[model samples]
Structure formats: C-alpha cells, structure tokens
Target chain A: MRYSLFVGCTIPNRFPGVENSTRVILGPDHLGAELVEINEFTCCPALPTFYSTDRVTWLVTAARNLVLVQDKNADLVTMCNGCFSSLLKATEELENVNKCNFVNAALASVGKQYRGRLVRREGNRSIYEPVRVRHIIEALYTDFGREGIADRVRHPLSGLRIAVHNGCHFLRPTTRTSVDDPAKPVMLDTMVEAAGATSVDFPDKQACCGAGGGIRLQVPKLANAITKDKYECIHAAGTDAIVTGCPYCLYQFDHAQKDLKVHPIPVLHISQLLALAFGVDAEHLGFEWHFVAVRPFLKKVDAVGVV
Target chain B: MTPGGAPEAQKKRSTENGSSDAKSAEGGPLIVEDSVFTGAEHDPDFVKQIIRYGGKDVQTCLQCGNCTGVCPVSLKTPYKTRNLIKLCQYGYKRIFFTIPWICAGCHRCHEHCPADINPAEVFVAIRHIEVREKGVPRFIRDSTALILRHGFGAIPSDDIKRYREKEGMPPLPNTLPGYRKVLSELEALFRKTRFTELIGLETGEGAAGERKARERGGEASK
Candidate 1:
C-alpha cells in the first residue's frame, strides 16, 4: 500500500537520511511518500508517562494523527520504533468502546478528534508486514513500465557479509507492535536478504542494539551493558558492515562504536546501503547523518548502471 | 469517569498517602494489624500450604523492613512488604489478596536480602495461592489469562490508555512485544520444559483479539 512517511520528530531534525535516504532509495523503486500532517502534532508523551502515570491525553493527541491518516485511508508508517508503538497503541486503545470515550472527550478540549482510525508516523518505521511487497508503493506509481527492481540493480553488493541488528523497539518491545520473535526475531535479516545482500547468521543476531525504552537516558550504564553484548555479536558475525532498520539503533550503534578500543566496522541504515547499491549518490543519501564515519569504499560502477 | 478524578483522588490519597511521618504515626511500624481477633488464627493447614509452596522461608523473616525499603510496589503505593510478611507469618489470610499484586517481579528484593530470602518469591507464592486456592481480582485474573494465553504481558485497555494519555502519561513501552517473541522462542526451545508451563506460557495464541475485553488490554504484534 502507498503510505505516508510519518516520521517522528527525530528524523527531520537529528538524523535526516532516515527520510532522505529512505526517499532516495525507495523513491526510484516506486515507494511514494504521502506526508501526513496533523495541524499540530505533539510529542507522543513518552517520557512523562514513564515518570508520571497518564495515558488519556497521550492517547488523545496520538489519535489526532491517526484521524488525519484515516481521513486519507492510507497506511501509517514511521521510522521511530517508539512513535510506531505509541501511534499503534494509542489508535488501538482509543478504538476500544469504554476507553475511546474518555480519550476522545479529552481530545475535544485540545480541538482534536480521533475517529477510530490508525495513522502511520512519518518516516514510517519498518513494519514487518505479513505480505512482502517487493516493489514499494512509490515503485508501483513511478516505475511501472521500467524493468523490475532486480534487473535494475547496478551494484549487487554481493561480497558484503552483513550483520542485521533489529533494534529492541522494532520487535519485542515490552508494550507491543513487534513483528518478529523478540528472542529470535528474523524480520530485519529477512529484509536484508530481500535487498539482495547476504544477512550473516550470528549468535547475538537477536540481541538489542542498546537503544531502547528510556534505557539510554534513564540509565546509560545499563544501556552500555546491553550494547556490550550486541557489539560482541556483531563482531562475531565477521561481516563487512552492520545494517539496522531503526534510526535509534543506527544512532546507538554508531555512538557506541565511536569510543570502542576495537571494532571499527561501519554502520549503515538499510536504506543508505540500498541506495548506494541501487546507484544513488552517497552525498544525497544523507551519509553524513552518521556519527561514526563509514569506511570509504570505491564503487565499481554507478548505482543505475545495469551491468 | 475522567482519568483526572483518580489523580485528584490520588492527590487526596497522597495527602493521606505521603502524609506519613511514619515515626510519628505508629512509632513502631506504620502497619495495620489483623490481631483484632476475627475468630481466625493462622490456619495450620494453610501454613502447611505456604511451606509446601516455599513460603516457609518467610517464617524466618526478621521484620528488618528491608523488603519494605526496596519493594517495587511499595515505592508506587503505600504498600508495606514487611507488614505483608508479618501478616503471612501471623497467619492473616484476609489481607493476603491485596498484598502482592503490585510486585513487579524484578527480583530486586531477592538481591538485597540479608537472609537470602526472596520476598518476591514469597509474593509469587501468595499469587499462586490466590490462583490455586482463592480466586483473584477479575482484572488480574483476566490479565493472567491473557499473559498465559499470549506468552507476553499486557497493557491497559483503551480505557486506561485514554485516561493515562489525558493525564499526560509518560511513554511506557509495553513488554508484550518483546515478551511475546521471547515466549514464542521459549515455547519452541523448551517445548518439553516445565519452566515454560510454570511461567504460564504454554501457547502463543494470546495474540488472538478477544471481543470479550472491556477494559481488557491491547494485543500487540512486533
């Protein structure tokens, strides 16, 4: 389904290629971006809820976005695992009879209304949808007459043995919205394979990238311990690079790798790698969003070159 | 109705809740006693049940209040983990129902124990007794049903979610997503292991949306 790029605040602000690269690579392949605009969308109320206990207004404001998406009948997508969880959780919760009334009434004062609909967060996070669409929604619109995506791949990225790190929130989140086995999740690896790169099998493949919940903020020490194991797993995979779908995971892995005494492997968002492989310009793909600079590699050919 | 009402009540409750200058209130312990002679003393048979289930360890509790100091629920509510232990040690069964539901199962108490006793385990024992002997509160019973059915835990239904959101709730990620995956794998890896069954995760159909849920929790996918 053609979906809106419902990005959470982080993408447009901090790590932009999240959308820049997502659009650059996915655009040529036919994933059209329908941006969802809530007259005024606010934070999903994630941090405050952890310190104080409230869900009604959080769900109410969250539904404001949902109503906007439902107005267009497009699928909701977001790059933030947290926003994805909040929007989906808020939508599902607001749809319930007993629950909807209070949240809707709360929304009334804020001049927002939720009409029992779900909206995707912008820069839509990776949804492990059950049906695999080889060509994105944009591809359906833009690349209809062209050769399928496979034939157009200019660079196979064949020799790359990639390690896939599924961020904690992507799946196996404590509250919900995960699409794979939290313990042995395989969605990200599967996607990496679909993109024509070999997803290396590793012992800690299912471990988190240490960017989860409020762990990074609330307890950096604890976050470190979690990432420590994740780094070890990635190291064992002996891959050419690390590929993660979540922006936060990408950020955390990059940051954690910066101070490391060992392990200088590069970290790339799945889309950036895909864009580079598909013949998109490295400069345009927001390669600069990364804190840890990627190792320079000479491309054998341009991304669009069929040979 | 509105979620605000409870916070107002909680605020009023807090005036009473946090109002505790415990040293001035009771001097010895800010505790409620069941020794008012309700014609029921500790049931030996029930005490036997406690021992059979491992609550026999609570019998040695020194009443140091360390459990009270670090209780997961007590920090949130006016719950007294030490007092609950005393009640169990004194054979108070009526107060047993409300004592342990708030325990978060984090094992923090066990780690801090001077006696190597697990108050968390004792709390679990209380839950077990409630499950096996006395019936649990409907909400908790349903929550357990959903958890056991789905293999992960649950979140408040839209009712609570809306209330919480209106209250400007913090972002609390539900454990179900991670737990469900963890349980699904555990179910497969430990198909024959009783630990899976002991934890009440036997199947993964907990993902099934039940129309029966009223204030029922949300079922999530990864």
Candidate 2:
C-alpha cells in the first residue's frame, strides 16, 4: 500500500495537524501504509476557481502534478477533497485520446508528458498500466477493511458522538469520483463507525461546507450562512464533534463556528480521530493547533479511559 | 393637440409621420419596444461555448428546479442553480457571469439533477466565460497570483511556522530549490494560453502587488 501522499496546500499550510496525524496514523507503528512525499509538488491549484476560469490551464496544471506522481510510479492519495477531485478527474480526462494529446503538448515545454495509460513491450510481451488516484478515506477503506480498522482500534471511542461531513468533492460529480453513491454517501460514516465512534446522521451531512468553489473567499457572508445551516444541523444532532476527510471543510467548519459565535464544537480530520483511537498522543496529533480547542473533548476521551 | 395635452392625438401624429419619439404627447417618456419578443435572445456561439467548456448537457436541462431545490447556497443567496441554467440557455451572459459565483460548488445540484445536466459544470462553464470574456474576480486574481508567485496558494506565516515547530513537526515545506524554474514554466503556460490576459494579470493591480510581495518573500526566504 505505497502511495505518493498529495498533502495539498491546505493541510500543510493551514492545518499541519492534519498532515502530522495522517503521517503518524499511517506510519509503520500504526496502519503501516508507505506514504512518500514528493518535494517538488505544487498546489493542486484548486478546482472550482482555477479550473472554472480556464479549462486548459486547469488541465495542464493538474497534468503537471500527475506527471510528478507518474515519475514516482506510485498511486496518488490526497487528504483534501479539492485536490482529490482535481487530480482524479484530471487523470480520468487525460486518459482521453484527444484531451491527453492536448495536455501532453502543453506539458512538452515543461519537459513532461501525461502518458496516463501506456503499454510497454519486452521480450514479445506487453504490460499495461493506468495511474490511480484515491482520497485518503478511500485508500484507508480499501487497504484496511472495516474489520481490519476495528481490530486496530486500541481504544474504542465509546460514547463519543461524531458528525461526519462528507465534503462535496469526495463523492460528487460522480462521473469523476465514483468512490461512493453521491446522493447517499456512507463511506465516511462507515469509517467513523469502524473507528468505534458513533457517526450521527445530520441533515446537511452531504451539503457543501460553504468553503468550496472559492465562495468562502468570494462571498463570505453566503459561505458563512451556508456553514451556519450545517452547524445547526450538527448541533441538532447533538454530536460532540465534527469529522471531515477534507481539510478545507475542516477549516470552514472550524473557522465558521467561531465567526458565527455558535456553540463551539471541535472539528477533526478523520486521520486525527483515527490516530487518537490508535493510541497516539494528542500533542503529536496537532490538537493544540486547532482554532477551537480540542482539550475539552480530549478530557472527555481521557475520562472514557481506553474502553 | 392643445399644447401636448392629449397623448392620443400625439400618438396619431407620430404614427402618421413614422417617427418614434422618446417623449409622449403628455411630455413624459414613451414606451417603445416594450415587452417585444426578440427571437433567440442569446447568440448561437454562446451555447456552443458552454458546451465546449464542459457543460455539454446544459441545454438538456428540464427546468425541474431540482438543482435549485438542492442548492445549499441558493437558500441564503439569490444564486439559484436552475435559474442560472435557464439564463445560460437564454444567453443572458451578464446574469450568468455574476450569479454563478454564488455557487459554493457543493455539487448537490449536480447530484440531484434529474436531467443529469450537472449544473455545477454548467456554472463552471459560465465562470470560464466570465473570466475569458469579462475578467477574473478580485478573490480569484489574488489567490491565483499567490499560487503563481509562491508555488502554493496559502503560504505558511511565521506564526504558523512557529506553531509547527512547537508541535515537533518539520518546518512547513517551502518551494523546493529550483522552484523558480517551475514557476516560470507555469507562468509561460499561463501566458501562452492567454490565461494571464483573460484574468487581467497583464495589468491587474492584484497581480502587481502579489508579484512585488513574492519578490520580497523570495529574497527573504533565500
């Protein structure tokens, strides 16, 4: 289970906790997935804003990142929904003959080619391979089945209610990302349950976190309003905390909760929670870096006493 | 007609002379070309552009309002996905340009569209049109300039760096050595593709400030 980890801009620059926790949870002492960092990688360049503005630039930029992954000869796993969608969909689109040719031409000047799916011949035999891109959740779900994850939980998070926010890009535009049923997604919830926590069903579980599509930066009031509905639903569910696979959604939920002056609920990337269940210390997991404090929640978890 | 006292007599005279005057017989405004139908309000190329930009199924929208019903932002903002689709089909470029930005890109509309029109993609197509034909929005210009300059959209601040250090994490990753080469390649691609011009980067104030800041930061990092 080797993957070139695509820790897109948000996770590293905004929430190093996410990057730290993901690395720790997936390190040899825990889930043991081989995660490699490709230092030359740039931003996934974001999709809604950048991609919408210019398809060619979007395709070319995404292709450049894909070429880097191809150079490593490893599948790409991203923790950010935006990066996952951009890289995965770009890979799918670049597999098209015409789109690939056009993008490859653009890559030529940059000294790269998106030979997305290629066959090589050796000794009267041929080998075929296609690039694979997956979100960290999908990679986890596939690599370690539900029971496998459950077995690894050193501390079952009993009585810890969690509201799972399946951010849009993870399950959306289904044609590009078919990891789960877009309309009724349960992958994240299933993973949450596998971690020995209760995954509460909220009304806006599948709604946008008001941060996607550059709306947070563009029309922040609208973004905050949309996030307000999500918080209301999460509050209605009476969950202790929120869990999201996407860092942008984590930032939105974390930041918006403060801006709206609502009852503060801690937001965690799934990896952070998984790291907790795997018996990693809170300090190493980057809990202190969170805007909304996780100490109260951690105190409660400590009271639970590894049951 | 008694010193412009009767609109009927003035209308009659104007009709007799085949003159479409701006003022009525009462010395008020006349309603010329009011509520008149003009066949196919949009240019044919408008539909073609939307399709070309990946909204191939936009014309197939059934107007069922399913997209609008499911849109998260539509509830708070006036950004109804269905209305935007309708406007796009009708070739209402101005409305399409401004209204599509309100979409949060949640894709609920895309997921629920009975027609599978993928209204989100349609909105992206509309945004593409807006950026190319009009100009990129300020937020987009600022953000894009950041990526263009720093090789990352959000540069980790000193405070963030200090926090990462406290956490025992490695300093946040900066642009790898020879990042300038990669940045230039990207810029050239942007230039050759005319994305620079389309987003008004050639003369955009946002781009200029971002470039200056990037230069200072680049030197400082060195």
Candidate 2 per-residue C-alpha lDDT over A1-307 given as tens digits, one digit per residue, 9 for 90 to 100? 8888888888877788898888877888887887767766777878865787888888888888888877565779889888988888787787688988898887888788876544576888756455788888988888887887888888778888999998988887335567987778777888889888899887757778888887787667777888998899999999888999999899899889889998999999999998888888887777765788988888877877634
- lDDT string for model 1 (A190-254, tens) is 55555567888877565555545444443344445556677887787687778877666777777
Clashes of 2: 0
Query: Lowest lDDT 10-mer window, candidate 2 chain A?
Result: A112-121
lDDT of each: 0.50, 0.75
lDDT of 2 at A69: 73
Docking class of 2: acceptable
In lDDT terms, how accurate is model 1? 0.50
Chain A TM-score for each of the predictions: 0.79, 0.95
Tell me how far the alpha carbon of residue A214 in candidate 2 is from the true structure, in angstroms, after superposition.
0.8
Interface DockQ of each model:
0.03, 0.35
Give the residue spans of candidate 2 off by over 4 A.
A117-128, B1-45, B162-175, B204-206, B209-222
Residue range with the least summed lDDT across 10 consecutive positions in model 1 chain B: B33-42
